[model samples]
Target: MKKTFFSFLTFFIFSFSAFAQNSVADEIKTLSKNKWQWMADKDVDKLDKLFDEQAMFVHMGGSWGKTREIEIIKSGFIHYKKADIHEVFSPIIIDNTVILLNRITLLAVVGTNEVSNPFMVTEVYVKVNNEWKMGSLSFSKLMGLN
Candidate 1:
């Protein structure tokens, strides 16, 4: 009787933990999607609110910080009219925090030079203070995209 009770107790705990993990993962995905939408709409205020103070953005060309990224948005260089997030894989949550490896394909027009670039992007998100934030980003132009 004791062995069966212990086995059931372990199974119950495992099931609850799995359910909680899935719930957190789904919340992270929704939060990430909202951030991308904010970026597409050029909502700098929201963007600023979405990033941690020490967040780092690494472009294919180089790197940028929170202030610089917001400045670039304010500069009106890239207008992201349409964005399609292809995949977010292997999202991990540890000790009330979540991390995701995301890949997105995007189309944007450069307002300054009248140039359009279609690109593939990789992003990472981390949950801080119960809010998911963009922790890092990198992008490369899609080849044969003219």
Candidate 2:
């Protein structure tokens, strides 16, 4: 009887933990989508809340902190015209950190040229004061035209 109860308790605990993680993952995914939209729209207000103070953004050209990222978006240095999200893979959750990987076709204007490219975007979120804030964003270009 004790063995059965212990097994059930363990199963319950793990199930609850997984459920919580899934919930948070879904929230993060939604936030990621919203972030892309905000970037396309050049909505710095929303982006400001989503990004952590010390967030880092890595691109093919260069990497910079949250301030520079927001400034770039605001200044139209690299406009995110669209993000055609192909798929959002399952998130990796470790304690207060979550890492989300998304495959997408990004349309943007760099200087005076418009370009489209496929990329795997890695987004890292960390929980701070009971809120999730994006800490890092890295885009890896994919080969071939899609």
Per-candidate local distance difference test: 0.73, 0.95
Which ranges of candidate 1 are over 4 A from the true structure? 111-120, 140-146
Model 1: per-residue Cα lDDT over 15-122, one tens digit each = 999998998888777877887787778899999988778878776557889898888776767666566766677567777556666655666666554444556555
lDDT of 2 by residue, 28-67 (tens): 9998999999999999999999899999999999999999
Clashes of each: 0, 0
Residue pair clashes in candidate 1 = none
RMSD, each candidate, Å? 2.7, 1.0
Q: Candidate 2: minimum summed lDDT over ten consecutive residues — where?
A: 137-146
**RMSD in angstroms, candidate 1?**
2.7
Q: Model 1, poorest ten-residue lDDT window?
A: 111-120
TM-score of each: 0.80, 0.95
TM-score of 2: 0.95
